[model samples]
Target: MLRYSLMRLGIFAGCFLALWGLVYVGALPRGLGDSNLLWVLLLSLVISAPLSFVLLRKQRDSMSVEIVEKVDRAKGRLQDNRTREDAV
Candidate 1:
């Protein structure tokens, strides 16, 4: 899960930097005042979301399966502990 999150963050950073460069080079328009940074962040999310969904599908699926397995194991342990307490 951490790996997947880091990968998404990396993608967003790459998008933001690329967009920032475009603005610097006069390729893209910059927003007024502090809205410039806000625009970059929002645009980065819009650009990165689809890219991450497509590129990180396998990693995301594996992370989810690992989480489910962990939850199942925790539940099994809890059930066993409850049974032991009841018998005592």
Candidate 2:
């Protein structure tokens, strides 16, 4: 689970960097470099950061629920085993 989370985060970061780089490159004029491009990049990151956090949180929450359900099923099986042993 830890590894999975790490990989997910790494992928997200890598993609974000790649996108920012692409935008920066695309915004460069043919004959002049504009400083305002930095502001645009900053704004884009600010907007995307929160959106990404919300998305990642939702995914993590769902994964956690799945893990909990699996544990609950295992516990039920254990209880059933104990009940059978008692009856015998």
Candidate 3:
């Protein structure tokens, strides 16, 4: 979970920096002027932050499901071992 959170943070930071750099380099047009550009960048960050968070959450959920399956398998093996020991 911690790793996933960090990964999402990294992705958000990278995207924000990339967009800022594009705007600075004149690759993207200014919304209207300095103020507009700032506003647009802020809006992009706001939107991207939540979208990334949701994506990370979905990824985490899938990971959790995989972990749960592994744990269940291990538990079953442990129970079988205990049963064999009892049979002896």
Candidate 4:
């Protein structure tokens, strides 16, 4: 789970840095280099989301399986405790 999340963050960071670099190089509008920080961040997120969705599909599936297994185990434990209490 941690690995998947960190990887997603790394992707976003990479995109953000790349965007910032483009802005720095005058490829994007000149004023947004430092003046429009929020726009830059929002654009980065928009770009990163689709990339992460495609790139991290396997990681996300693995994390989902791990989470589901943990939930099932916890539910089973809860049922066992309930049975013990009812018997008492």
Candidate 5:
């Protein structure tokens, strides 16, 4: 999970930097007046979301499986405690 999170953040940062560079180079139009930074940030997030979804599919699936396993273990523990209480 931590690995997947860091990878997603890395993708977002990469997109942000690349977009900023493009704006700096005047290749992409800047947002009106004071909104250029906001524009770049929002656009990078939009671009990075789809990229992370596609690129991190395997990691995401593994994370989901890990979560489900943990939940199952917790439920088992709870049921065991309940059974012990009933037998007391």
Candidate 6:
């Protein structure tokens, strides 16, 4: 899960930096006046969301599996404890 999260963050950071460069080079339009940074950040987020969804699909699936395994383990432990208590 952490791996997937970090990968997602990496993608966002990459998008942000690339967009920032484009804006700096005047290849991309900048936001009006004081909103320049805000504009770039929002645009980066919008671009990164779909990229992460497509690029990180495997990582996301593995994270989900990890979570399911943990939940199943916890449930099994709870059932074991309950049976032990009943036997006492």
**Top TM-score model:** 5
- Clash totals for all candidate models: 0, 0, 0, 0, 0, 0
For model 2, how does the per-residue alpha-carbon lDDT over 1-88 read when each residue is reduced to its tens digit?
6754774666556655765676658763322356454655455566566666766786777778989999999999999999999999
Order the candidates by lDDT, highest first — what do you get?
Answer: 5, 6, 1, 4, 3, 2
Off by over 4 Å in 1: none
Q: Candidates ranked by TM-score, best first?
A: 5, 6, 1, 4, 3, 2
Local lDDT at 15 for model 4:
91
The deviation in Å at residue 39 for candidate 3 is 23
Model 5, range 1-88, lDDT digits (tens) per residue? 8999999999999999999999999999999999999999999999999999999999999999999999999999999999999999
Q: How high is the lDDT of residue 23 in model 3?
A: 71
Q: List the pairs of residues colliding in candidate 5.
A: none
At residue 42, candidate 1 shows an lDDT of: 90
TM-score of model number 3: 0.47
Q: Estimate the TM-score of every prediction.
A: 0.91, 0.46, 0.47, 0.91, 0.97, 0.93
Candidate 2 to truth, TM: 0.46
Q: Write the per-residue lDDT of candidate 1 for residues 44-79, one digit (tens) a residue.
A: 899999999999999999999999999999999999
Which clashing pairs does model 3 show?
none
lDDT of 5 at 16: 99
Model 4 misses residue 87 by how many Å? 0.8
What is the lDDT of every predicted structure here?
0.93, 0.67, 0.77, 0.89, 0.99, 0.96
Mark the regions of model 5 whose C-alpha exceeds 4 Å error after superposition: none
Worst 10 residues of 4 by lDDT: 30-39
| Least well predicted 10-residue stretch by lDDT in candidate 3 | 32-41
What C-alpha RMSD separates each model from the true structure?
1.1, 8.0, 7.2, 1.7, 0.6, 1.0
Per-residue lDDT tens digits of candidate 3, residues 1-88? 6777687777767777777777778887667655755755586678678778677887888779988999999999999999999999
Per-residue error at 78 for model 1, in Å?
A: 0.6
